[model samples]
Target: MELSLSQCSKLTWTLNVHFIVLDCPGTASEQAGKSESCQGCPNQQLCASGATKAPDPAIAEIGAKLSSVKHKILVLSGKGGVGKSTFSAHLAHALASDNTKEVALLDVDICGPSIPRIMGLEGEQVRHAQKRSKPFYVDDNLAVMSIGFLLSSPDDAVIWRGPKKNGMIKQFLRDVDWGELDYLIMDTPPGTSDEHLSVVQYLSSTHVDGAVIITTPQEVSLQDVRKEIRFCQKVKLPIIGVVENMSGFVCPKCKNTSQIFPPTSGGAEKMCADLGLPLLGRVPLDPRIARSCDEGRSFLCEVPDSPAAKAYQTIVQSIQDYCSNRATEVQRAT
Candidate 1:
């Protein structure tokens, strides 16, 4: 059943599977004109104020939608606290900064949905549509959605079990109103948990294109990255390579670089070489980045001159280069 809304006011409708978001003023006219019921829309009744809530999104239906989307990439790591979410947010932000492409950041880390906060969007939720949950825009080129948006407060915990976590992820892939996107960056939670497995399961079936594994230069984190790579191998999910984060720390006083974590077993370069995947790039432990994120700001604009921002730009550019070169290699082999 659909909710019959009388204007976009305080008229409450029981929560349904989906809500008629298109019932709003101008959008309603456009959608109604395209629907099968358009021919019989009498007296302009549909747009004349009395509108109803749309049905909830079918579970599989939403997943199918995501599967069809082009350039869906899952960002994963073997462990937590390696700034995976920050990398996801910045990467999406970098892509969105370009006027040519569309970008979306899906915070699959439901427990600590940091993308909303990292991208300078905190305490933001879906302004419209009470029934069907959807994503909201961070800006023109970039749009973001996270469970954090739905929570009553930022401190709230999801507290879901396996089945529930799995369902929530499936819904995230399916139901969040992600429009046409050029790149969809999925930030999975740390480690191989139910939630992480769910993201992989969803994307692999929904035609997930590839994955980017994030890790720090420390041996502790790199060990897990290798395992994560192996897991992808078992699942047949394409690996795009690894990113070394918090690779080093930069000084503000004398500008000296210091090691934060123990060097990886094979070092960053050798580890990638051994794994036979490219070492995407290494990010220094820059305080500006953490400060910016904590303050709910995008350092892309503010810290372009900082080490972290430059590294981010390099990472995105390198991804483009790697993709282009790989395309060339494929064409040559063909």
Candidate 2:
């Protein structure tokens, strides 16, 4: 029996275990509507509510595509305005600044694509080659991509639903031509949304090296960060560690550091201790860091001797150590 997409509704198994192919929701969903098998799924609520879906990611395709990339790191924050994106940009910049390693920065923050602006590639567009889009090269060692590059203007808004967002992220992972790279740093939007879930699903085969969570010193921010940590735990994503951004304000004239947010008594340090996670480093609140970001300049280059720059270097070193150790472990297993 032949059926069109309109005619096919439920996904069922016939006698003798014959598979009945129906028009899927285009994603792996366990909703108890068209598919009879879905009715018996334990995670029906998770699928039906559209909170998260277990999509059948193209593992082989993604793995082949990202085979050359040595490491894939995701920068995330449960709360907004924790400087996740800024940290991502600088981290990539710092890595690429090494001159020996190749780095790629991918901005998956669909609604608010700021990497193009932050990286000073606002007007740059993604070029195509053999059907695969090429990432914008910031330098010989650095490349970047963002939905901002696809937009007509930086001010243009991306009003998309969850499925659309997921599709775009999938395209980024599958279609973008990111040759060999030392690191592919993804700057995700605030909170665990469709983008975060999609990235994890698609790259499950390619392997996400780990996640670096960013947070401020205030209790309001730390409280939300706790949720971010839990999200990683639930998803089984190994967290590299926590970074305490804006930990203190460095005085420009006197070369002094002050506790601006006042660490909420225990703050990030104590929180990390309680969670048994490493505190990578503390990034001080510096006006120059903001100025460098706004001007599309590399903060490390502008203020190599600054305390914040030194902190970033320390954090980057810790990340390198983590990646190197993981690589060694994989080799031993093989």
Candidate 3:
């Protein structure tokens, strides 16, 4: 009875829940009763049936509560400085590059958020509009939320205890205006700390789904990544697969490929093989990739023909296949 009721509720407000937003200058804590509905009301965007802009947040609220979104994936890494954020940024850009799907990137990495920089948009923060806080929309197909965008500067270090961090993330999940999303990719901070625990626990409570572990080809990194897999299994979170980053570097001058990270070096793929997980794709080290990041542009979105771009696309396609097969497998299991 409850499930049927929930589905019906989602259908009832499907049209009005999704709205586009741009951030304004203000602190989230200081802003109260502030909105930018005048900019672009969602009711106007949701339909063309002569439906005027909605005056209430109820429609969007219903969409959040009841809508069965296609997927909520976490792009995770076992260790820090592993290009996990880059992987996430590219995955999202690849997914939404077509402008056919409604995609969102949720930066749960409160300590170190790079989504804003990776996506090539800076100086935008989450803003409240139309009686709901809106994710900063970079394009028609993509919306992003991150502490990096909210913080005044990149070097601005946030110092808060565990419970507070958890509460803040929960608030993002609960209050921020995520509507009728085809996918929500959460980029998590490295380490199995309170931040990670909070995220996994919250998703478990909400049935939000699983993650993709990012790792390098080095055995040392793979060792840490293996611990991550064990951690996921402990928490009952599903492992989508493993993404091998910095597999090899190709020289642009001579078109020569170099084995910067040894093949079977870290045994990441072997670990996946032993554990029965998919090998999503391998990414190479590209100087232009780092340059693009330094320039604050998404490598894939800005330069689609770049090696980084193609690598990300392959990973995106692999994920698409995984989801398709997983869905079918689920149906059969049931």
Assess each prediction's global lDDT (C-alpha) against the native. Answer: 0.73, 0.84, 0.72
Question: What would the per-residue lDDT of candidate 1 be over residues 1-334, giving only the tens digit for each residue?
Answer: 4545654344433221123322322322445444433333442454444352242344357567875455777888888888888888888878888888888888888777888788777888665656345677778878888888778787799887776877878877877778787788889888776886667655644556577888887787788888888778866888776788887787889989888785847556778888789777888888888898898777787778887788888888877665556557756999
Query: Which residue runs of candidate 1 sit more than 4 Å off their true CA positions?
Result: 1-63, 127-132, 322-334
lDDT of prediction 1: 0.73
Indicate the worst ten consecutive residues by lDDT in candidate 3. 24-33
- Mark the regions of model 3 whose C-alpha exceeds 4 Å error after superposition: 1-66, 127-132, 263-266, 329-334
Deviation in angstroms for 112 in model 3?
1.0
Q: lDDT winner among the candidates?
A: 2
lDDT of 2 by residue, 41-108 (tens): 44445557655554454656888899999999999999888898899999999889889999999999
Could you tell me the lDDT of residue 181 within candidate 3?
A: 77
Measured with C-alpha atoms, the lDDT of residue 208 in candidate 2 is 79
lDDT of 1 at 296: 75
**Candidate 3: tens digits of C-alpha lDDT, residues 235-267:** 788888888888788888898898877755445
Each model's TM-score, in the order given?
0.76, 0.83, 0.75
TM-score of 2: 0.83
Candidate topping TM-score: 2
Better of 1 and 2 by lDDT: 2
Q: In order, how many clashes per candidate?
A: 9, 0, 2
